[model samples]
Target chain A: MAVLTLAQALNQGLEQALAEHPEVVILGEDVGRTGGVFRITDGLQRRFGPERVVDTPVAESGIVGMAFGMAVGGMRPVVEIQFMGFSYPAFDQIVNHVARIRNRSRHRFTAPMVIRMPYGGGIGAAEHHSESTETIYVHTPGLKVVVPSRPADAKGLLASAVEDPDPVIFLEPIRLYRAVRETVPEDPHTVPIGEASIEREGTDVTLVSYGAMMKETRQAAEVLAERGVSAEVVDLRTLVPLDTDRLLASVEKTGRVVVVHEAPRTLGFGAEVAALVAERALYSLQAPPKRVTGWDTVVPLKKSEQYYLPSVGRIVAAAEETLTA
Target chain B: MLQLLTPSGDVLGEPPLSVDLTRRLYRAMVYVRTFDRKCAALQKQGRLATYAPFEGQEAAQVGSAAPLDPEDWMVASYRDAAAMWMQGYPWELLIAWRTGDERGGRPPEHVSVLPPSITVGGHMLHAVGLAWSARHFGEERIAITYFGDGATSEGDFHEAMNLAAVYGLGVVFFCQNNQYAISMPRTAQTRSETIAEKAIAYGMPGVQVDGNDLFAVFTATAEAIDRARAGDGPTLIEAVTYRLGPHTTSDDPSRYREESEVEQWRRRDPLERVRIFLSERDAWTPEWQERLETEASTEIERAVELAEGMDGLGPARIFEAMFDELPPHLVDQRAEALRSVGQ
Candidate 1:
């Protein structure tokens, strides 16, 4: 085992994938010489050679569309779209082609590829730099959406995403890229695509979140524990093909739930989680499900970003509301 | 600008192809023309859905495809049935696709052709990627993508071109400039004069060919394929032709184009030129034409029957292809679908 940051773990995961599968390749803007704008792919091009780790022209649609064809042509391409905001240019390819190829061809052709983008907001950045748009991918059928909270999960989930037979949209939290370190396993590992991991087990209320927001939710859980309100923290690793079984079990145990996300509250992934709990575990719930989320407006710039994003206090208050009810 | 055969049954110079090869090309054009007419008739009879006819563009499709290795990848739009068929996509599957069956989209594993892309311009990049994959795997295979004049106007066309040129990927951008994109004329589509010239901005060699002449298309595509196989990157071949028919079965050409223009193109028909060339060489006889038509008609009839004979696919089959294994939500949705159908 080795202590590694989320970025390092992701690099290691990509390295392992490249080594294990001859068909696996990595392509993105600045992924070659610059080692990616975030340096997550640092030295990957030198290690894997230019053929496997390619630096494509600045065309998001071509990057994704070409990867889709490569996948069909028997290559497992892991593509990176510099940031979440830049992924929109490739949205048509993702929604229209990547998500539909398998269903359209009736299993004759499949796009076994992964599109990774650094998402969410925390570090001061310009407009269009920080955005939480996982809900759009989650809503599209025939795609698996994955998010990882820790370094170890990032590696394992990325490996799984690369090996999956269907297209996967792997969203990396921009803020969490270098935020934390953990002893990640050196050997190859896979975190299944549709499973949820319970970060902390409590009986009073469930604080559900994933990706960057997990840090705030974890903090909220600690504060609630200090206040004598035991809270369970469920990090939903995959949004699409949601682990409803795990979610319902957690809700049934706690009998109260507060879903949290950095995306806007209206029609966000939080709404899906809240609705799932209401539909399946409503009778077991001691109180109505609550949501702690970013406001239903564009994520603000650096100065007012804190006001727009869900904070630790917001999560704690939501959990407290569930506990009181 | 290259021409081996003129529109009036005369050779421009020494024929680039042998008499036997010219006769074969003529026959293939006749066969595809029969298939195109049959599809149009079927669509009119309500037996098939919207059909994109490639009647005037047969030479561009067949000639470009003739030089391709069977293993080469082909990504084409809705109208290039002739090209796809030449690349080993079965005619039955093509008909089945037009009949709205998903099974039609599933080409045989040996065939490297993708399903016809309904959306314009997006699939060109896919061809680039496939060729890139081939290069990565140390395979000598090349990829070719087919689209029309209107497709060049899409932003994806520029992206695909730049990527292919930058990476030196083995691909051929086969754009059949068939004059109109639905109701929009070629003149209205772009002011660049010719689509081939667009390759200049991307730093790739481009060629303009007489699309109605079979020998020119065959020679140009052959050269392009050789360059790609030699790792010379990609070439953009713009086959300038006219759409003799409507954009599709649902479209009426009279709305935007003059009948006089259509009449002029008819005089330069892709098939008639080849037929004239074959006749001048005494390779086209009445008996031979009769036998070829009978064979092509029978083959098409069988394919249509096969396409129409399959049992309707159910909701279970519809749900099966979405993923290797169904998730809980899809399982629930599939159950609901089954219940609704009284299955």
Candidate 2:
């Protein structure tokens, strides 16, 4: 086991996939010669001899549509969208074709491809670089959406996403690229796509979140613990095919819940989690499910990004409100 | 021999583009025309749900499709039944799609063709992508993708054309400018004088041919395909044609167009033009022509029976194929569906 950052974990995962599956290929802008904008694909083109690691012609829809065909042709394609904002052009291919191909074909074909994009605000980036739009993917059926906050989870989750025989939208928190470090287990087994993990166990209140929000949620849990309020933290590894059983069981045991995410509040994944708790574990809840999410407005420019992201203070306030309610 | 052979029927040409191929071309067009008419009637009788008839556009489809190698790929829009049929896609598959069976319409990977795209211009991008791969991996196979005048209005059409042109891919953007996109006239569809001219923007060769003229369509398409096979890059061929029938089972053309205009197009009907050309060339004979019509009718009748005899598809098949390997939640959903259906 070797300690690695989120960037290194993702790179190790891509390397492992290349070694394991002959059909596995990588495509993205700057993914070849420059090792990707983040260097996740660094040393890959040289290792795989460029055929398996492709640098596309800066066409988002073209990359996705062709990857869809390649997957149908019995190849496993792991495509990287340079940024979350740049991925919108390929949204039609993702939702209308890639996600619906199997359902529309009545079991004749499937798109077992992975679309990797760095998401969420923070790091003072320009417009379109820091949007947390995971809810949109989670709303779409026939797509598996996964978000990883830690380096170890990034390795395990990405490996699982690449190997899964279904279309997956893997959203990595860009701000956490070098923020967290942990031992990246070589030859680590893939984590199941729809399972959530209990990062910390406590009985007072549950902090439920995924992606970048997991960082704030964990920090808030620590802050609450200093005041003797033991917080239970649940990291939702997969967003679309959510681990409802794990979340409901955790909230039922804690008797309180606070859902957190960086997407806007109106119809984010947090709302879905809140609705699920109200429906499935309402009696066990001592209070209504609370939500800590971005405001219902366009994400402000980099100068105001700190205000846009759900902060540790916000998660703490939401958890305390859940306890009081 | 089939009637309506090309004027060049007597002229000796290359092995694949010879006078003998004229009779085969005419037979295919006539068969597709008859099939289109039968489908219209089926829609009226409610035996088929809806259909986009390709009555006067047989030459454009048959001419372009005739040159494709079995291993070469094709992607088509909704109004491409003639091309799909000529390419040996089973008639039963089209019937299944018309009858609204999800399982019935996907292009067989073995056949190297895609199912008809219902969206206006969506499949063109796929065609460009596949062709790009062929060139990238050193495969010489070409891809032909069909679209309509309405599809030209889509952003996807321009995007696909630009990408194919830049990559020098082996893709033929075949556009059948069939007068009207439902009710909107071609004049209203684009400000440009011709759809082929749009190709010039992408730095690719553009050629315009009479879609009703089998000679012109055959010659132009064969030439474009030759250019593609020789690695000369993408070509845009605009087949100027007209749709003589209603847009679908639901449309009434009288609401949008003049009857006199329809009458004029009817006079220049693709089928009639070929028939006259073949007769003048001495390729027409009464006895053989009658046998061809009888054979086509008998084949369509058998196809209708075969399509109707297939097992009915249920709604649950929709969720089954969404993934190659079912995830855990989907497995649960499959079980739930089974319980609901008492399976």
Best by TM-score: 1
Worst window of 10 by summed lDDT in candidate 1 chain B: B310-319
Looking at every candidate separately, what fraction of the true A–B Cα contacts under 8 Å does it contain?
0.78, 0.36
**Candidate 1 displacement at residue A76 in angstroms:** 1.1
Structure candidate 1, residue pairs in collision: none
lDDT per model vs. reference: 0.92, 0.82
Clashing pairs in 2: B4-B274, B4-B278
Candidate 2, residue B41: how far the Cα is off, in Å? 1.5
Residue B337, candidate 2: how far off, in angstroms? 5.4
Q: How do the predictions measure up, each by TM-score?
A: 0.98, 0.92
Expressed as tens digits, the lDDT of each residue in B233-323 for candidate 1 is 9999999898899999989888888999999999999988788778877889889998999999999999999999876577888888889
What are the per-residue Cα lDDT tens digits for candidate 2 across B1-343? 1122333333223323444677788888878877888888888889887988888788889988988887777888777888887777777787777776665666565676777778777668777767755765677778889999989998778778877887677888999989999999999999999999998999999988877767777777777788888888889999888898888878999999999998877776776656655666677777768888888888887877777776666645656676666666678888788888898
In candidate 2, residue A36 scores what lDDT? 92
